[model samples]
Target chain A: MEKSKTNPNKDFYGKTLMGIEIFVRSLIEENVDVVFGCPGNAVLGIFDALLEISGIKIILARHEFGAVLSASGYARATGKPGVVVASSGPGASNLVTGIADANMDSVPLVIFTAQVPTKLIGNETFQEVDIVGITRPITKHNFLVTKIEELTSTIKSAFHIATTGRPGPVLVDLPRDILAEKFTFDYPEKVNLRGYNPIYSAHSGQIKRAAEIINNSLRPVIIAGGGVTISNAFGELRELARKINSPVATTLMGQGVYPEDDQLSLGMIGMHGTWYANNAVNESDCVIAIGSRLDERVTGDFNKFAPKAKKIHIDIDPSSISKNIKADVPIVGDVKDALKKLIPLVKNLNNEEWLSQIKKWKNEHPLKYKSTDKVSVPFVIEKLRDLTGANAVIVTDVGQFQMWTAQFFKFLYPRTHITSGGLGTMGFSLPASIGVAITVKDRPVISINGNRGFQINLQELATVTAYNLPIKILIFNDGHIDITRQWQELQWRKKFDEILIDSSCPDFIKIADAYGIQSFRVEMANEVEPTLKKALALKDKPVLIEFKTIYEENIFPYIPLGGSVSDIIEH
Target chain B: MRHTISILVENKFGVLTRIAGLFSAKGYNIESISVGPTEDPSISRMTIVTNGDDDQIEQIIKHLNKLIDILKVVDLTNEPFVERELALIKVKVNPYTRGDVIEISDIFRAKVVDIGPTTLTVEVTGKSDKITAMINMLAPYGIVELARTGVVALKREFKGEVYTSKEIKLIKKKSRQKQVEDDEKG
Candidate 1:
């Protein structure tokens, strides 16, 4: 059953240059439309090969981290394997965080990092790092190319593994010697990695059991997780929900899985989840959790979460099933395939008592805010939602504003909401939104940022303007790391509350102007929408709309640690 | 709401640790756990006692079976099955009341593996209830040591393969189609 390597034609031959040609050729043949990365000395040979190639657009990012994050955005938007290249050492190290972020969130990415020449390895060579060793814990798998001809198959396998089965990041580290070597290239027809097989087919017995449980339960709810979004199972999820006539609650990453305005949709649920979403979970007697791990954010106080509900967890990764919260039934397969089987079997689940109970809870504690003449964050988010018709792609950096966006913005489609949920990586909004804006050329892509989160990766602003991307960055300038300072002040009695900053900040409008992009400042509630519209009206280059507002604002509907969703703090 | 789950899996390296880590990482409470090799060398049986309802037990079973090396999982909480636990408890016994403990162990058919003037170790394998009954019987003699392997079970005559999602779908589809026809006629 194994392919014998006794055949001379199949043996790997030659040096680095031939390997580079073969590897780059395989990527081209796979129809990879773009690659985002920053090159260095070790990767110069590959760059030379890339120079001769056309049709694949290479985005030169300001930093390797920015490139990988942008690729992450592209992957999330298109369900494609995002590819990024980096030089040895520093270049490879820069990609570690982004690759880890993709791994944590299960985003498909093929990251190529150059290594020192094979002869110089383990000799403390210049610009060298043990990239493969360092990336073991973060990547699903990695490759170290020792042979020249193995390059094509290795790259092919990397792509295959990255995109298939519970997709995650994979690293392909090619040494300078391998890149300079010459070898005849032949792509492998199939992958046969022993012990690495991923199941794609749905097991019918489990589906029927899930259906039976759903039909028999008095109060049933469906909790959609990031798996649904990753699988592009929005239609399937909606169909199954409609068939069951069930209300749907989602994790932070599951925001765009369904139209937020749908009657059965309960919106995003977690630490700062909506009151209706959290309470709906509490009221359900049965929960059909598809593509979500039911993490701490989704299931606060694990013992008390969904106390009355039996869970049926559907996920592609077997490791996720009942790993956190218990499941009444577990279906280990692709979400799309599993849902396809469950759709026809789904029955009308009528629990009027449960429905009305959730409705009452929703009425008692809806997502509400009070705004004065000074301006409110929620009011700005509401205005943006209204201005964009709730249709624009929203990319958010982590902070108080990200939670506020989730609370206020009405997302109407899958992949329309993009953010680093699991990693919570700051400064992800601008570059990610720029990448999304490039592909979604006509539609507006808004990068919602906080003052602190924006400061982390503000250098990408130059990249945005250089590409002439029409990305609108709405900066919520609270003049501090408001979330942390608020936590320290609230929890620590403001002791050593040296966290708050009252100093005047750099004018973001002036910063954008320096980058050859449009800028506007909204210091009041009335000016928010008008400034936002001005930015959205731009056709070329990027725009920044800075909201100079109250700095002490905190995201409410907070679920204290070890507390249930019903214990939300309204303030 | 406590249940005993019996898992039959391949006796592969790291299987036990993987299962334990899974529960610990999820913050799931493991009330008690017992595992041992079965009559077949290639297969091992694990008995896990957890606190949860019927729904929770089902989830554990479904997830356990999903592990690549796991052959089957059976929730023997309510099913007609025979369950047992083996615990080699070392009791800190003195010269006094030593005979009473030996007499009690003999009554329960438990063998004394080692004996000392100050300590006595007993090896006993029986149903969890039987073990508890024996422990109660020996409690009066001033027992000092305690160790237990969680409960493991096997259905006396049950024979079938684990049902998967694919099979579940066909059953429901047929039933639904039948229901539609019945409704139309009615």
Candidate 2:
């Protein structure tokens, strides 16, 4: 066996590969199988290398946001950092909302953007935007590739950081000059990012302290946050909860972190959260907030949120400790790692009395909705969930319907429930659903959206049909932003401005028909399940089911910020 | 509840804009913000006052620190810090009250350097409370102009090092690598 003329010098060997090739090869090595992007002059080199690759398919999206959304959907589905590539300036700027959504949701994603040549960067060359700076707050970390030598390490670091503790989006901004430059590619053995030191394992002492706090409490409630899902610690969380016999209440983003059918599960808590879940949080002696920041939506009134409880916050982000609703015991590490450290230290005491008390609270304050003469959104969501067998992915746009879907649907698996919880970006559901459907071709994915949210991104309907995806869009067509409209009706006495759409939106049924997809509208309450079943029954192309809804509907169990979730104002 | 926080961050591109975007997206009202590079070459300090609860304020700080450019967040409200707010108040003073105003400025330890025929410009540097007190006393004299540098603070025992996020990161990285090396050699 002859090893032909290997370069004796390490530096000489490494100096042979181009930076773009190094970055591309690094991504492939990280098990990245696909990239969503559109190429331009700045990123022509990368596109050339990406073209030669046979396994990693590159999906050319019409818009940068669409590509990023598809990447986000991919991240949610696979629990790996999804990748999106875009050219400089407008292309990068368009990815802002998608990146912001990932930041807010803590979804793992990698966005690669081309910049103007290094020489023209400060000179404001054409199509040059400070993408790294643009994406700072919306990213876990970011890099500006200044040299060809840094490209390989930068890509590796970005992947490591993005998929690690408290996963979020990361951007690698490449200047055109660097991409055009030639350098040898040697994949870095390890990343050496200066400021990023993520602790994946919990400190044993802190974990023990947390366990002691949990053991000593009477009414202990596990306030599961998005962290559980991010860490893939559902099994551990379930075991710990079962060991302690404590009920688990989730934040909106915390859906699917625990099995919905678990006996100890109390469902989502906060504004528009279930009564039992909120009551459990309020009445608990100890509030073990795992991976949640206790955002205003979750806390309701901050001062009063779980006021009586001794808070124990376990999060990877240090700032989250005592940042919101001060924690008595704060454990800074990954939720899974924290649980692993703490579980053994905790005494397996059965809090049967506390559990029974919570059960009573659940029985007394079952989520009550007024039986209006009109068809209800919850009824539609419930039927849809049943027809799809809870196996279908549920995507919701933010509003009354978003909350209602949370209330109605029970998610058993992680990533099954995808919603814009952080950014709460409207029109996100349909595009994201299309992404999910594309990724999971066999699963029946459905986007349950409000009429207004559906209108915001209805243009994606063309993309849906163009791709021949099997996703179904169920729109709660109330004709306006019902959540904001309800507040307007209540606070301003019918001075409605923001919620009302001036121009009538195109008929979704007609629009779907034009797109060559099956469409239906259900007005009567009895017609909802049948309509949903019909839509689900069709597996060839996407379907749209529009339910005629009342214009001004409000989500109930409403705790205005800084108030206890238990003290809800029903609409 | 309202909180005024000072954040020292690296003067990287899009950082301030990103911070502004975050505040807007989160629906937090940013009452005032002043940002510029400090004594350090690379770092910039941003003074932002937001209205919300203590918890909300802390959350804002945490989220702000999450930005790659942000070095550290100092809730100057709790710490022993020197806060200065510069205000250029152009008061429409008649000759009769001009002397009295100057005397008052002397009493308050303020400087009245720019003087016009009908108006006098008083530059004051003090804590927000101190500035507000002087402004109230000067208000009765029919003030024609008012411009204020909202608020800026520095820690009293300040080491004049650049407080960029990058520097802090470098320190952390160094320490972590050292630890790994130590573990390997242990």
Candidate 3:
């Protein structure tokens, strides 16, 4: 509706609205359903504007870090760009880790941060930080809106840049003065960035060449990554794998992109990957790496990673194609598009002997763990996965619990398993689980975290209780950073250093109780399942179940640093 | 393993920072970088010289192309391109070496832009190698100060599509109108 009385250009303008209102309206135009925010003095006007908006919901996080992590989780789970807002200075600085994580993982997010008034910006005013400068490297793109005229357009550009191409976090630093200023509310329908054009389809010639390579190779293994999930190429990945009679191995980030329970699945392939997965990748004649950057954790030693294989890397980001491992056939396009084109050109292969060899390797060195007298983290993860089944969304924090969850959980679907794979951010689980729970309200959302990791953002418990989110928080309390200690023990001649956490770690059950969340602690093996079940049964409120796991327990099937895939320590 | 890359980008705020940040974050050492406005006021071109192996340079080009403000990235190191650097050198010129300095500047086709009692400022614009050679020849006269504008490069012949300012503006406007119409229909 045009407000001709107040508007100079009736055809191009609408009713005059506050800059804050325009910002919120632009987000709504982008189809953002929820915004995770922690309000401060600079963002009060925006908060006031948000209260009047009926269609969008704002989830108030206790900390700015919690807000961004939750938004990242929501983005990964829903396949939509997550939105977050925070006040100036410390609030914006607090978002650095989450922003970096989102960028590293290629999760789409649009972050709005409050800035000090434009006049007070460079005078060293209170609550003023060069947020744009700080986040320049981490964010895909960012804006510092100094003028009211640039507010809506900047917000629109931020959203477009965040969700397109290689999706990553984008920030818009809104000055407090602009938030209070009045402006015409004209949301741009589309952003036309001349520089940002992403290739969605593969070249037919390259696809044909890739198919020929796959069809000719008797020992071919497919290595899928987060790109597969991001592009929704799981179906295509499966079709291609089935056609070529190839076993599929996934990177940690690509865990759920292919069903782990499938006969052709080779679990995960990396440092902590299963023996068979590593062996299959090492022994393969051809390696089809889709949507993966081949990070150091996955590659072990770049010189020897898939050495014998003729590698084919298909990714949306061309920079990721040969950054770590050189690809013979580099298809710079979306994984789904590349796979779709490739499947048609590939003929069904009879690699029964190669498959049998892989099966023998799997039988010889399956994922093994001893069930000790005390409760173990991996055992709990397996039992929890069994109880929750394949429908539950699993989120994890970094460290030992993260690796254990990745190893034990059998994800049958994409977007069902969420973790900070690239950034390896600790304290991501609890808040991220809150986000996943919000996105998929009907499914069970479980967060598996270590004690050291969970306490990084323990304040998020308040947000979970405030929203009455039914997120099941499972804390594996080993009393210290278990993975670091394990590494020190193995590599540094058992000289335990700063890896041990101080005894001053908070009483987690009491901490959860303080936040009005249902809390439980289990130490015995028999009590684990019942505790998990009890936590899962609660429908109206969030629950925290802490298991006192063995402190010295180490994750096995580890490939030593700088070692090849074949040099695995399977203890 | 030196590579020359020419980047065409929108003349937007923070575009330089984004490009520089990408290079540093990815661990590519920039040997030299020069940014200046193109013929169109709305567009800027950046010439970056960096040292990396073939794969690293390719990755750098690809990464540069990924930036939202970058329109085009041309790695001219492998192409037939002409590159030039401008340097202003002030040399301490005594009576004995003043004639020698003037002779050297004359031989190199450099101009003496400024003269002080004991120093002569020589301005030289040539290929990077020539400029370096000139500086070395003037070093015998005891150089006092030096400032150099990093390399600016261009291909001898146009090989890619070049967008005029009007065409770019028109394309931007048309795309926006189409998007607005689509939104209204939806």
Best prediction by lDDT: 3
Q: Give the per-residue lDDT digits (tens) of candidate 3, residues A153-196.
A: 78888887888778999999988888889988887766768888
Worst 10 residues of 3 chain A by lDDT: A1-10
lDDT (Cα, tens digit) per residue for candidate 1, span A209-256? 988988888878888988998888999999888877888888878988
Listed for each candidate, the true contacts retained, as a fraction, are 0.00, 0.35, 0.96
Best by TM-score: 3
lDDT of 2: 0.80
lDDT of 1: 0.80
Better of 1 and 3 by lDDT: 3
The candidate with the higher DockQ, 1 or 2, is 2
Q: Is the docking of candidate 1 incorrect, acceptable, medium or high quality?
A: incorrect
Q: What is the TM-score of chain A in candidate 1?
A: 0.95
